[model samples]
Target: MAAIDVVVPNYNYGKYLRTCVESVLNQADVAIRVLIIDNASTDDSRDIAHSLAQDERVELILRESNAGTHASFNEGIDWAQNDYFLLLFSDDFLVPGALKRATDIMEQNSAIAFCYGRDVAVHGDDPVPIMPGRTSPVAFRLHKSRAFIESFCRRAVFQIPGSSVVVRTEVQKRAGHYRTTLPHSDDYEIWLRLAMLGPVAELDAVQVGLRTHDSNRSREFAARQLEHILHTAAAAESFFNHEGGSLEDCGALRRLARQGVVGRAYWSGIAHLLRGDMEAMRLLGFAIRSSPVSAVVPPVSYLMSRPDLAGRISSFFANSARSRHIVF
Candidate 1:
């Protein structure tokens, strides 16, 4: 059996699919199976996928019509049959030896259900840079289920990059499929569920190259902050509304997450208001709707009180990537 089963869900990203598939096909020190699931692409993606399927390690699932991302994600989850599984978007590629590094940590720590590392973004039409894994290996940072949620979800901030995360096959199977309703933040929501299963391993290394282009999903959401807020909120709701709420301190965690989202939203709103830009008022509106109590406290007062948050909102919203980076 292969060490890992990588599911590459492609749309019309023909230019990037081959590079993404080949990245895993070319990985050394680990055996991986690649499944290129094309969701009725209209571009040259089908041909490109067929050509890549020539490799014995690669297979194709060409859907006649588009069934949506969650469909592909769920299909991949159902098809995974290896020790490890990764749902890699067609726009991302792993660096050399990334699989081995991540798998090694999970193997050593039986308590860990998944592992993730850093990922650098490459712009359009560019090749994934040659990163031969991290030169100086750092110790793996392990976060218990609730602890990981506290560090990330409490602030409605996302730290894990989807491409960088590698999960245990059985654990992923148990975590269940990606939800269709959370189209924008399904990745975020799935990470939350997986963390609920066991401790998460954070490896200190750049493991994947996440390509950015006009058609990229994260870029689209960054341009629509209002919709993005709702999507992320839906993810949190999905998690707590399920059995995940049984975790210790679930109520406190939920309250803190709401406060964090509401607080930062107000701060973002204040920044935009200072510039006389009403477009960002969506942040304030969302904050008010999410938590009336938190929304009443002036954003500046919140920032002043928590000195640590002084420049977070300003810099986060300064650019699309940074803005999308905060509430993954």
Candidate 2:
């Protein structure tokens, strides 16, 4: 068996598939096995996979029908026969020396079930720093299994990009496979589940190039992605209840849920306010009043409730919006 198994789940990402595959193959020091699970793409993705599979290190699995991203990922993980696993997406490229660096970190830290590095978002030649703008939950902190889950339940601080992470195969097997039902945010859900098993080690190095284009999933299905996040937050609440977490843990989970709801309401309200919709302003006001921070930020709540004031504030911010606020 190979030392590490790299799983690439592909749909209609033919344009970016070749570059991603090539990047993996270029890793010289890491003894890696590559698996391409194609979700019955109408494009030439299968042909590209077949070409890569000509190498002894690669294998390709062709699904009969279109299973979503999560299903494809699970299928690949199930077939892995290695000590470690890395899930690389079709639109992302592994930075040079990433596999070697990640392998060394995981080997040195026996207690860490997974390790991830920073991800640089690439739009053509320009590189965008993804994690520096916001604080990450998984960085600079070594967490126990339950603590990691509780923290994630409270707020997802780390941007756990798939291409940049390497996980112990046994931890994944013990935690059970990825939940296929989670169509969009399956990676986030899986990370939470893995945190229940062991600690996650993180390297401050940037090791993956996550390409951002017009056809990216987030840009294409913005509303659906938001809905998935809200649903995942709710699911985490129920999971925590059944596991019998402490009162403090439960409170943290509830806070996380409220943050998700408030965030959705706030952003949706902004979108509507930009379109000059009074009903949207009222809805946003109700959300602010219902949120945890409402009591302290009563002025914000009051302004959001009135169409005129909300419009004025929205316009003022539109002129010079420096950064987006995190409602939670």
| lDDT per residue (tens digit) for residues 196-251 in model 1 | 88999988888898888989978777766667666777788788888568878788
Which candidate leads in lDDT? 1
Candidate 2 residue-wise lDDT, 1-328, digit = tens: 1388999999888878888888888875779889988999999999888988998988888887987776777787788778898889888888777777777767767878888888777885344333322222223445677666655544432356778878889988876676655565656667776776678877777778888777787646644334544555555655455432544556666666556455545555665555565545654675576575743443333233332445655655675354432222
TM-score per candidate: 0.89, 0.75
Positional deviation of residue 190's Cα in model 1 after best superposition, in angstroms:
1.4
Q: lDDT for each of the candidates?
A: 0.80, 0.68
Ten-residue stretch with the least lDDT total in model 1: 319-328
Off by over 4 Å in 1: 135-137, 274-276, 295-328
Candidate 2 Cα lDDT to native:
0.68
Cα displacement (angstroms), candidate 2, residue 159, comes to 2.2
